[model samples]
Target: MNQWSGVNALCYYLAYILEIYLGFSQSIALILASVAFTQYAVFSWPPYFYIDRIGRRRTVIWSSVGCAACMAIIAGCLLNSSYTTSAVAVAFMFLFLDCFTMGILPVSWSYSAEVQPLRVRNKATAVGVFSHWMSNFVVVMVTPIGLNSIGGNYFWIWAIICASFVPLTYFFGVETSGRSLEQIDQMFFEHPRWLMGVEADCTKVVKQTAEDEEMRHKAYAKYDGFDQKEKHVEVVHHEEAK
Candidate 1:
């Protein structure tokens, strides 16, 4: 999800795109690229507050929609090949950064870690990070060649990839928000379907079971503490009476 989104392509190549493809002056391209990155950094924070509240599945799905639209618009503007369209393309590029930061940027790593079983979580997260960097390398290497050859048409490829994530996520993605690791593990165990949309009931049952178990443990601990306090008080009274 992270690799194919074309974010690295844009990040590594934005100056190149602005100066080479869009015909901006070198200094102007550098400035614009820096500003875009600043926007990327600033926009990354807002999702932190909302991602869990909105839920992972919906966040990624809707963010992909916005990303796809931005990519398509940027592609279209580049294809038009005029000063006015170039300006519009620059605006959409900023918007694209906003969309990516809000959705995939925050959710991907956490979601990957959350979905793994406890035993293999460390290894699994490492593998996922490794895969992400490898894919990043591939995209970064391919992007300049793609731009040189395909021109504006190159971003349409990203647009399609972004659009495809919506359905792919909806069909296969589990709702990880508010679910404990145990609940998630049990959900996969019980359902085991390629399509996870029907796992709601199973997840609820697992969650309820976990809650009951937790309450039982708390109750036991409370009673144990009470008994210890009573024993201490009785020991003090016996000592005083003597």
Candidate 2:
């Protein structure tokens, strides 16, 4: 996020300088840009097409590439001396930014619902969400200071972070598209860092949750009041004739 948003920061800083240089109404341009962004909101859920078809790993990988491309293009345009170069760069950068909602990172909660087993899935998801938001909080607080201090070279800095995630995804990310808990467990068992604190037994933990969910469902069905009540029939006992 730091690097991804760093591109936007670059656009803003560049836009500020460009506005002063161009002497055209930048405030109006900014307003127009915001309106252009509304188009993205208008056609919401473009990722809905691929989230189920391509799976989380592919979606994340593709979006990671997108963030990289967006930053790189912005950097290239800014590096040029011509004002036209910078303007085109800003336009393209904003276009890409608007489309970022279609990225896999935003739809992760949906992925968790599709992937995790039921019993302890809620617990696992809660922990995962906690870690994600905690990291987001830390990154958002620190990023502005980092970008301001670094100056123009910060675009490259953001590029490096986005680039780093691609390899990490390739090496560590599993294909959870159509796979079940047991398959996910196999993926985890292959890598211990995946589970955190529990080490080797985390695979077992995943499997146990799957089993628990299955057992709970069966138990609930067995005890369903309407069906069970019907199952019970009154039996009259006749005393032996004396």
Candidate 3:
């Protein structure tokens, strides 16, 4: 999620950098930025439908790799400092944003929420959200400083981070795409690190159970007065029968 935040924060300043640093005209930079936005919106979803089909872990890892490669290309262009390289860098930035939207944006929340146990899921989600926002804040605050101090080479730091995330995800990422929350809990309990092969079983029963429990809790909390009234009515009926 920090990677998601960081990359997104960088994108806000990219047009300015392209215009000033890369010597692009304002109109050209605006066009590139608009194209980037279109790419972002277009690719942000549809991959989510395949999260189960393609497997979440693989999707995330490969997406990280793709982003890393894009970053590397962009960094290379900046390092070389030519008009051609600048154009290539602009293209790579669009590609990087596409990869981020497709892979990281969709799964970031679902993956975090799904991995947590039911009892603490809400708390976990809150923490996840906080962390995500915090990451965004830090990236937004630091990016300008980094850009000023280090110039285009600042992207190399993100590229390395993206590359590192790939292995970290592969080794630690649990397969929870097709499993029930209960199954996910059990898998974490038993293995805690990995799952084996071809597991896309639907989670209908588990989903129903969770929903029913949630409804029961809500109903009980809302109807304490009704419960007391029913009890009093039963007592009166018993007295009348006596």
Candidate 4:
């Protein structure tokens, strides 16, 4: 989960280096890239809406593969010296950014929000944001080195990086669709609980804990440490007297 999502978060950072490579119209291309990211972010929401439905594994796998192809295509476009190359490259690059941002980008945050205990949701969200930006900073600094390479060589490097992330997603990402939240718990946790021959709900861990505590008290039939039969007899006597 961390590996797939972490890489997806870094997609724009990698693309920033590749697409920002100076050329005939570099400044204009960059501004367009920024606009595309904001504008296209909406389309990517379908990925979010359906991620839990279609499942995280498929979404992550496809998004990583698509993002890789986009990078490779951008690199190929940049290699062309045609006057329209910059325009086409930026156009496609934004598409890839949009895909990543809306798709694999939010899955981990969703998981984090759902899985983290309520006491730490804010902290969990903060940590997620922090990790996101930290990676952003790293890629921002490192990407320039790729940019310094000869024309579009940065894209070639990013193409490789993008390609590498796909397999990482396939192997490490968990599927979260269709199954009850309990199944998702088994998929990631150290000790998965089985309830009456079925998996327990992962998302209901806190609720389950409360239920179990109440059940424990009922099972013993002991109010204030009274013996089980004594408690039962007392209840019966009270009912008869009524």
Candidate 5:
């Protein structure tokens, strides 16, 4: 999802695109790129507060829609050489970063971690990290070539890729918000279908039973010389519980 979103492609080549394709001077291109990143940094904070509230699947799906629209608009704008279109393209570039930072930037890594079982989580996370970098490398390597060879049409590829994520996530992705890892595991175990959205059961949060809570308290009290009143027992719950 992260790799094909064309984020790294834009991040690595924004200034180059501005200077070469948009006819901006070197200084102006650099300044605009810097401002775009500043905007990115500022927008990144909102997801920290809302990822749980809005849930991961919706965030990525909607963010992808925004990114695809921005890419399409930018591509269309670049097809013409007028000053107004150039300005629109630049504005959309910043909007693209806004969408990315709000959704994919924060959620991708955490979601990858959340989906893994505890025993193999480290290994799985390492593999995910490796794949992320490899994808980033591919995007960065081909971006210049695509921009130079295909010109503005290159972004159409990204627009299509971004647009595709919506259905892909909607069909295959599970709702991780407000679910404990154990609950998520149980969900997968119970529903073996590849299309998780069909049943929509995973979206429901399972409350911990009173019997289970009592058993946990009894187990904690069994320890010798420990102050049960002061002992902190960390209970993991789904995002909605917060």
Candidate 6:
């Protein structure tokens, strides 16, 4: 989570930092930042609609792969000293923004919200936000210093971070795309394995709940009749005694 969140948070700052390290003009930096932001805004939500259709886990996994690849390419561009490397790096930066916004940005929040029970969801979401911001804070603080110290090599660390997310997501990611919140809760209740990637059956759960309610209603009606009969028998017996 921090891997992508931190990268997304600190990436804009890189526009200015790169001006110094890569010796690019401020005009070019501003243009790159503008283009990246525009692409981010345009591509972010459209792909999100497909999250349910294609499944959340697959979207995130594939997007993470794209982000890692972009980071690697950006790092390689930085290592090269040709004039064309600047343009290529800018292109990869745009790719990074697209990939991050499309998958990591929305999934991080939605996935956290879906996995938690309704009773504690607000508090859990708060914690999730805090963790996310804390990661951003750390990255924001460390990035400029790291960029100065390591130059282009720092991006390889981010590439590795992005790559590591793929397996972690595949192993532990719960598919909540078509499942209800209660069904997700039950999934965790029944199988507490954090590493198990399972999709919930909300239809079956809802059907079973309705069946249980119907059975309870019938039992209550029968019990009510039995109580009334007992009361009538007691009344008759009391009058005979009198």
For candidate 5, write residues 1-242 as lDDT tens digits.
88889998999999999988898999999999999999999999999878887788889989999999999998998888578989999999999999989997888989898888888999999999999999999999999888889889999999999999999888888888866687678888999797886667865433445686687668666763355433433223333367
- Per-model lDDT: 0.88, 0.56, 0.76, 0.58, 0.86, 0.75
In terms of TM-score, the best-performing candidate is 5
lDDT value for candidate 4? 0.58
- Choose 1 or 5, whichever is better by lDDT: 1
Clashing pairs in 1: none
Per-residue lDDT of 209 in model 4: 44
Model 2 CA deviation exceeding 4 Å by range: 1-24, 112-120, 180-242
In model 5, state the lDDT of residue 222.
72
Positional deviation of residue 223's Cα in model 3 after best superposition, in angstroms: 24
Candidate 1 accuracy as TM-score: 0.84
Most accurate candidate by lDDT: 1
**TM-score for every candidate vs. truth?**
0.84, 0.61, 0.78, 0.60, 0.85, 0.78
Off by over 4 Å in 6: 2-6, 198-242
Model 4: number of clashes? 1
Screening candidate 5 with a backbone cut-off below 3 angstroms (N, C-alpha, C), the clashing residue pairs are 178-238, 178-239, 179-238
Model 4, span 36-137: residue lDDT tens = 666666765677456655566566667777777776777788676465876677667677776576566677567566544556778988998788777666
Candidate 4 residue pairs in clash (backbone atoms < 3 Å): 182-202
lDDT of 3 by residue, 114-214 (tens): 98899999999999999888888788888889888888788888888889877776656666665657778886666532432223332211223457668
> Ten residues in a row with the worst lDDT in model 5?
229-238
Worst 10 residues of 4 by lDDT: 196-205
lDDT tens string, model 1, 1-242?
A: 88899999899999989998788999999999999999899999998777767788888999999999999999998887789999999999999999999998889989999889999999999999999999999999999899989999999999999999999887788888767687689878878888886456532222234576698679879999999999999999999999
Model 5 clashes, total count: 3
